[model samples]
Target: MKRQYLFSAFLAREKCLLYYQGTIRYVVVTADSGERIQLGLKHFQPYFSALGLRGRFRLTLTETGAFDSLEQIN
Candidate 1:
């Protein structure tokens, strides 16, 4: 079963990638749109929620792309 989640993110430079359990999956944003990043959290919701992550998550941009470190805020 695959689940999809849509959420907004703030990237360092608008370009980023999505990582699930140390594996990169989706590219969230691009350098041209360096403001806000929208992520399509697909098929990895269970893994993400398992780590107690829900709602909006923070993203950090690196040379590769944007990644969620699974840090949740209440």
Candidate 2:
């Protein structure tokens, strides 16, 4: 069986008071009905910048959580 998830990814900036940096890049997504997935700057920046920033997308991942493909939804 194949497993898939629908998520809406968007760029977010989190404020950091302790660190020298003012904000950090983050990718936040609604993974399931009520689940949220967040990725740091290094994890999702490439994909988010290319397409995800626009709107929702369908994510296909392996059982081990490896990225397979991503398609933007209309």
Candidate 3:
């Protein structure tokens, strides 16, 4: 049988911190409560274009409780 997972959503603000690790670029997300989540270049670029790294966003998690994706809420 196939297994299923649960997903969670939370509100977080876009926090852009551009940096390079050797050659790969990354962006990190910071919540108001002081939690941080780092995103990869592939993931960050697309959303950054749409959201522009400001305002509030709805953060979604994967079935395993890891950061999956985000969308602008405000």
How many steric clashes between backbone atoms does each model show?
3, 0, 0
Give the runs in model 3 whose Cα sits over 4 Å from its true position: 1-24, 49-52
Instruction: Using lDDT as the measure, name the better of candidate 1 and candidate 3.
Output: 3
Look at candidate 2 and tell me the lDDT of residue 64: 78
- How would you encode candidate 1's per-residue C-alpha lDDT over 2-73 as one tens digit per residue? 222334334321122335444555435333335545445553254353333334443444545644343333
Residue-level lDDT of model 3, residues 6-47, one tens digit each, is: 222222223332322234455466665557765554544444
lDDT of 1 at 19: 51
Identify the runs in model 1 with alpha carbons over 4 angstroms from their true place.
1-34, 47-56
Between candidates 2 and 3, the TM-score winner: 2
**Candidate 2 local lDDT, 2-61, one digit each (tens):** 456787665433322211262555546677666665544444443444322455667677
Best-to-worst lDDT order = 2, 3, 1
Lowest lDDT block of 10, candidate 1? 8-17
TM-score attained by model 2 = 0.50
RMSD of each: 12.6, 5.5, 7.4
Say what the RMSD of model 3 is: 7.4
lDDT score, candidate 3, position 20? 22
Residue 40 of model 1 has an lDDT of: 56
Question: Sort by TM-score, best first: what order?
Answer: 2, 3, 1
